[model samples]
Each structure stands twice: as structure tokens, then as C-alpha cells.
Target: MPKFAANLSMMFNEVPFPQRFAAAAAAGFKGVEFLFPYDHTPAEVAGWLRENQLENALFNMPPGDWAAGERGIAALPGREEEFRAGVARAIEYAQALGTKRLHMMAGLVPAGADADSYRATYLANLRFAARECGLHGISVLLEPINGRDMPGYFLQTQAQAHALREECGEPNVKVQMDFYHAQIMEGDLAMKFKRWFSDIGHVQIASVPARNEPDDGEVNYPYLFRLLDEQGYDGWIGCEYRPRGRTEDGLAWLAAYNQ
Candidate 1:
């Protein structure tokens, strides 16, 4: 079975952030991932991880002022300085948390802008972040989120993510394969998963369309998990899904998979 990581940002909402680490541990998750760790001091989060005996599977680089509708700044024009600064800050936190992966969210393309301009800016920013992250033994990932979730958001397909990574010319840059996003944007999940398996560094899962628990929707996660095992994918699979009820109640699928 693929190793599993609890997504603290989306899961375990019944408890506070700090307490979620212990909650995940109690629920049998050996690793964890989250959105941003800016508010909590690195030392504080490190302490929690140590206490819970969980590996920091993954976390995203800052995406600018999230409250102001900025999904990410990497693809935004004239934000190179802010983007690089965010990369540096994320590195500091990653080092402290012993995390080896960071996802970079490509921001939305402005209404009047074209794909060429956004791609150029995104590639440059990814290269810079990839180099910085590479120095810390971390892989920089670019996730292709679906337009339904965030319309106009740059980078919305596996092919586009691969193209950007190649254009970035940074060996450390890789793809964060979120199955839920892929299912939303395209069908034939298993075929695409196999096709792009090599380029993927980290993985996330949720149900299709609704983004709920994996088993509740169209995606057949068990077969995919078996395929991953057959292929020897030794990375963390983040349970990046929302619960239909209590978070703990939704973990039956995890137990079934482990068996």
C-alpha cells in the first residue's frame, strides 16, 4: 500500500490545528501535510511533529495574500520579488519541519493576459524556487488544479504542469498529482496516472466533482493504490479531502486499504 498522509488543512476540522497532529497520529497516520505554516512559528510546528511522531510529507509555498483572492503570485507580472521571497520563507519553514517537498501554486491569469505571458512568468518563478528548494534537499512541485475549483487559475492540467516543469529547466521541479483535480479536468484516471507517474513526486486524493472522501465518488482509489504499489511509488499519498461527517468517521476507508 502507498504511504498515507493526513491533510491537516482539509481534514480533522473538528479540532484545532495544533491538536490535529495528535489526532492524525491517533488515527494511524504516520505523516501529515498542510496549506501554509506561516502563522505558527517553525519551532512550534516542529515540536508538534516530534511529539506526534509524524513526518512532514508536504506543504505549499506561500501564494500571496490569500484573503485578497490571490491563489498564487508566481504567474503574476511584477511579483517576481515577492514570489522569490515567499520561496525563501517557505524553505526556512521546510528545513525546520524536516519536510522534503513544497507545492507551488500558479496564480490566476489576469483577464486581459494571454497564456504565453503567464507561462513565461510562471516558468521563471518556478525555476528560482526550484533552485532554492533543491539546495535544502526539497523537491518543488507544481500542481495543476481544475478550472471548476478556481477558474482562470493558471496551470490546470497534467500536460501543462509537465510542460512548465520542462521549461523551468530545473531538475528539482516535479509534478504534484492531485487525482481529484485530474478527474475533474479529464477522464481515464488510471491511464493518465500511469502515463505521468514518472514525473509525479507527490500525490493527493479526493472524490471527483465534490472533493469529498475518496471512496464516495467515481474514482476507484483501491485499484489506483494497487497500481502504485505494483509500480513501487515510494512517496506519500496525501488524503486531501473534506469529510461528509466527523473526520474520524471517514477513516474506515483507510483501515480497509491497509488490510
Candidate 2:
């Protein structure tokens, strides 16, 4: 069965960030994930997890200036120092939170930027991140966001992500296969899952086009869930979607699988 983790960033918005941990647990989630936890102390976040008994499945390495719209800095040429610092900061939090996986966002590619240079920078930064994270038993993740949702984002396809992972040649660097982006860019979710089963480190899901709960989407999640079980995928499937209504009201689809 698919082990679902609520994305506290998108779900349980009725309360503040700190309270979402309990909200997710009360809703029967065994695990949880979020975009960034830089605003709070690691001890604070850790306390919530320990209190709720929810496993911290995943979280992204600090994306540069999120409010300023810098999705990530990993692919930016001159920001290598800042990117490395972010990696160290992320490791501190991961160690405190006992999180094993961290997603390294590829920054938005500036217009007129040299594609080759950006690719080189991204690859180098990824190798550095993998080495640093490996020392602490943490895995670094690379995700491909669709152009429609995140224009100019560096990584965009399963092939591209896998290729980069191979080029990095680091055992701990893996791909974060988000179905929301995958369905938007490539519709063959099952085939992609099977083809890259060995390289995937994490999974995320949301309805296509609407980015809502997976129950009423173009993608048949039930079929894919069965496929995951058949293939013996023992990883957290993050519910990284916005609810159409209240978050709790949209959990009927998850109730059957929560057990």
C-alpha cells in the first residue's frame, strides 16, 4: 500500500504552521513533508514530530529568496558559495529532525544565461551537495518541475533528472518524482515509474491541471498505487496538493489507505 504523507505547507492551513503537525496526525497521516522550515528552530519542528509520532519524510534545501521568487540557486553560476552554505544549514536541520532526504531545487534559469554554464554549475553543485549530505547519512534529491507551473526552472523531465543523477555518479543523489509535475510534462506515469524505479528517492502527488486532491484527477492514482505495491516501492508518497475545499474535507480518498 502507498504510505501517504501530508504536505503541511499545502494542507491543514486552517491553523498556523506549528499546529499543522498535530492536524496532520489527527487526520491519520503517518508522515509529513514541507517546502521550507527555515523560519522555525529545528528543535521546535522536531518536538512537533515527536509529539505527533509523525515521521519527517522530506523537505527542500533552502530555495533562495522564496518571497523574492528565486525558486532555487543551485543552477545559478555566481551563487555557489551561498548554495553551499544553504547545504550546510540544511544538514543541520536534517540532523536535528532525523530526516534522511533533502530536495535541492534547481534555480530558475535567467533569460539570456548560458545554458552550458548553468548546467555545469548545477552538476558541480549537485556533486558537492551529495558529498556533504552523504557524510551524515542523508540523501539529496533533484526534482523536475514543469515549465507551466514554474517557468524557467532548470530541471524539467525524468530523463534530464536521471541523466544528471548518473552524471553526478553519487550513490546518495536521487530523483524526486512528483506526479503533479510528471503528469503535466509526461503523461506515462506508470511507465516512467517502472523505468526509473531504481533511481527514485521520493514521490509526490496532486491532481493534474487543478493541483487538488488525487481522487478526481486525470491520473488514476488507484491504479498507480496498486502498481507501486506490486513493484515493492517502500517510500513515502507525499500529498503535495492544495485542497479544493477544506483540507480535512478532501481526505476521503486517503481514509481507505490510511490503515
Candidate 3:
């Protein structure tokens, strides 16, 4: 069976952020992950993880002004100071929550922005983030988000992520493989998983074409789970999907998998 972490942001919407910790624990998830935890103090978030006996699996760094249509500022020109500062804040939260990995989103490329400029800023930011996070024994993961869900999202393919990681040359930089995104972009799931296994640090799952529970998607999750197990991918598979029904009710797939 595959070990899954409830994506608190998407899964436990029945309650508020603070309460979702207990909700996930009750749902048989040993770990939990979310997009961001900045609204709550790290200490407050840590208390939730500790009291619920859950592993703080993953989270993203402070993306600038998320409400202002800013997904992240790491690749935005002239935001280097803010990007580095955000990394520090994220590291504090990771330490407090006992999380081992933090994801860095590459914000949209500004229209008319120089392509080379975007890549340079992005790689530089990733290098700094990876090095800083490394000091605290945390890995920095770069996730290639599909443009369909996030139009203009900077990183949109696994190969792009790998290329950036290599360019940054940071030992702590690794890939956060989301099967949903991979399927959307370039999917040969089993083969790609094996090919990129060494560069991958985390995994996430959702159905293809319609980001729903794994049971109803084009993906055969049972076989995928078996593939991961056989390949020894010992990382959390974050359940990041929109539920077809009430989130709990839609978890029959997980239940059947004995998660």
C-alpha cells in the first residue's frame, strides 16, 4: 500500500485550517501537506502537528501577495531580496513543524519579460533557496505545475525542473513529482518515474484530465502505487485533488487501498 498525506488545503475543506489537522488524523492520514501556512504562526502550526501526531510533510515558501495574483516572486526580476527573505521564513516554519521539504513555485513569466532574464533570476533564487534550506537539513523541491491549472506558471515540465536544478547546481535542489501535472504535460508514468527516480524528492497524486480522486481518473493508481513501492520511492504521495463529492466521501479509493 502507498502512504498518502492528506492535502489539507484541498482535502479537509470541511473545517478551517487549524482544525484540519485533527480532521486528517481521524481520516487515517499519517502526514499532511498544504500550499502555505503563513497566516498561522509556526508555533501554532507546530502545535497542530504535535497534538495530532502527524508528520509535517510539505509546504511552500512565502509566495508574495498570493491574493494579488502573485503565485510566487522568486523569478520576478528585482525580487531577490524578498525571495531570500521568504526562504528564511519558510525554513523557520519547516523547523517548527518538523517538515523535511519545502517547495518553491516559479511564478508566472511577466508578459514581455526577457526569457533569459526569467531563467537567470529563477535559477539564482533556487540556488539561494536550496543552499539556505540545506543548512537546516531540509530539501528544496521544485514542482512543475501544469499551465492549464495555472496559466503562465513558469515551470511546466519535469524536464524543465531538472534542467533548472542542474543549472542551479544545488545539491539540495530536487524534483517534487506530481503525477497529475506529469500526466497533463508528458506522461509515461511508470517509465518516467523510474527514469527520474534519483532526482525526485517527493510525489503527489491526482487524476489526469480532471484532477479528481485517483479512482475515477485515467491513471490506474493501484499499478502506480505498486510501481512506486517496487521502485522504493519512500516519500509522501500528497493527495492533491478536488473531491468529486464531499472530500471524505470521495476517499473510497484511499479506503480500498488501505491507506
Candidate 4:
């Protein structure tokens, strides 16, 4: 069966972190992913995970204004120092949590920023972060957000994310394939899954249209789950979506596959 990880940020909003961890474990999920656990010390977060016996599937590196229009310039000429510091902080937390994967937020490319310069800067930062993560046996993943959902984001396409991973040439750096965004930006979901499976380090999903429960929207998640199982994809498919009602109310959809 495809292991499911509740996205605590979305699922258990209003619940304290420790409670969220325990709730996910009680719900029969073996793993959980949070948006940013840095607010809590790594040791504290690690202790919670151990208490619940859950794995930390994925967590974001500091977004650093990517949510505003600042677009991450990890490769920006003047921001190299800031990027390095961010990576170091992330590594520290990932180590404490015993997480194997860290998602690098590639900020949007600035207006009039030379593509070559941005690319070079991004590649440089990625290489540096990859080395740090490699030392801890952690893999760094770059996620491409949809321009529709996150306009002006730097990495928006799987092809672009794939190319960046190739250019960085770091074995520890790979792509995070988010099905909701991919369904919007690129169709032929299964084909993309097949083509990019080799480079995809992690996966996340919510149903299309409403971005609610998997059964409440257009995607055929049962088939998708079956595809992942058949292909032997052994990564967590994170439940990253907005709850249409109470979070637990929508969890029944997972029963289809959880059984």
C-alpha cells in the first residue's frame, strides 16, 4: 500500500503540534509532513516524532518572502550569504528530526533578472546545500509550484525542475512532484509520473478543482495510488490540501486506499 502522510499544517490547523502528531498516528498514518517546523526547536520536534513513532516525510526550507512577491533568489548575486544561512538552519532542523528529505524553496525569478545569472546562482546554492545534506544522508528536493497558483514562482514546470536537478548534477538533489499543480500545468499525469519517476524524490496531492478530499474532486486517486504501487514508488504521498469541512470529516476518503 502507498503510505500516506497527513500534512499537519493543513489537516490539523488550530491543533497544537504535539497533538497533531499524535492524531495522525492514531488515524493510522505512519508519517506526517509539516510546513515549517523550525518555529519549534529540532530537539522538541524530534521528541514528538519519536513519541508518536512517525516519520518526518518532508518539510520546507525557509520560504524567505517567496509568499510575498520577493521570489527566492537563492542564486541572486547579492543573496548568496542569506541562502547559505537558510540551508544551514534547515540542515540543523532536519538532523534533529531524522528527516531524509528537505524541500528547497526556489524563489521566483526577479523581473529583469538575467536568466543566466539566476540559473548560475541557483545551481551554485543547490550544489552547496546538496553537499551539506549529503553529509547527513539527507536529500534536498526542489519543488515547482504552478504559476497559476503561485504566479512568478521560479520553478513551475517538471521539465524545468528536472533540468535544474540535472544542471546542479548533485546526486542528493531531486524534484518534488506535486500532483495538483502538475495536473493544472501538465496533463497526462501517469505519463509524467513514468517519465520523471527517476528524478522525483517526493509526491504530494489534493484533488483537482476544489483541492479538497481526494474523492471530492476530479482526479482518480484510486488509479493513481494503484499506479504508484505498481511502479514500486516507495515514497509518501502527502495529504496536502484544504479541508472542505472538519479535517476528520474528509479523512474517510483515505479509507478507500488505506484498507
lDDT, candidate 1, 1-259, per-residue tens? 7889999999999999999999999999999999998989999999999999999999989999999999999998889999989999999999999999999988988787877877888888888888888888999998999999899999898988888788788888889989999888977877877888888999899998788888877888898999899888999999999998899998888997565
Using lDDT as the yardstick, the better of models 2 and 4 is 2
Each candidate: RMSD:
1.0, 0.6, 1.1, 1.6
Model 2, poorest ten-residue lDDT window? 250-259
Please estimate how well model 4 matches the true structure, expressed as its whole-model Cα lDDT: 0.85
Kindly report which residue stretches of model 4 are placed more than 4 angstroms away from their true locations once superposed.
66-71
Error of 4 at 37 (Å): 0.8
Candidate 2 TM-score over all chains jointly? 0.99
Candidates' C-alpha lDDT: 0.90, 0.95, 0.89, 0.85
Candidate 2 lDDT by residue in tens digits, 1-259: 8899999999999999999999999999999999999999999999999999999999999999999999999999999999999999999999999999999999999789899999999999999999999999999999999999999999999999999999999999999999999999988999999999988999999999899999986999999999999989999999999999999999999988976
Off by over 4 Å in 2: none
Output candidate 4 Cα RMSD: 1.6
For candidate 4, lDDT tens digit of each residue in 11-53? 8775877789988887888999988887788888999899999
Pick out the ten consecutive residues of candidate 1 with the lowest summed lDDT. Answer: 250-259
lDDT of 3 by residue, 1-259 (tens): 5789999999879789999999989878899999999999999999999999999889999889898899888788899999988999999999899999999988998677798898889988888898889999999999999888888889999988988888888888899999999988888878888988999999999988888888876888889999999999888999999888788888777786662
Once fitted onto the true fold, the runs of candidate 1 whose alpha carbons sit more than 4 angstroms away are none
Give the TM-score (vs. native) of candidate 4.
Answer: 0.95
Q: Ranking by lDDT, best first? A: 2, 1, 3, 4
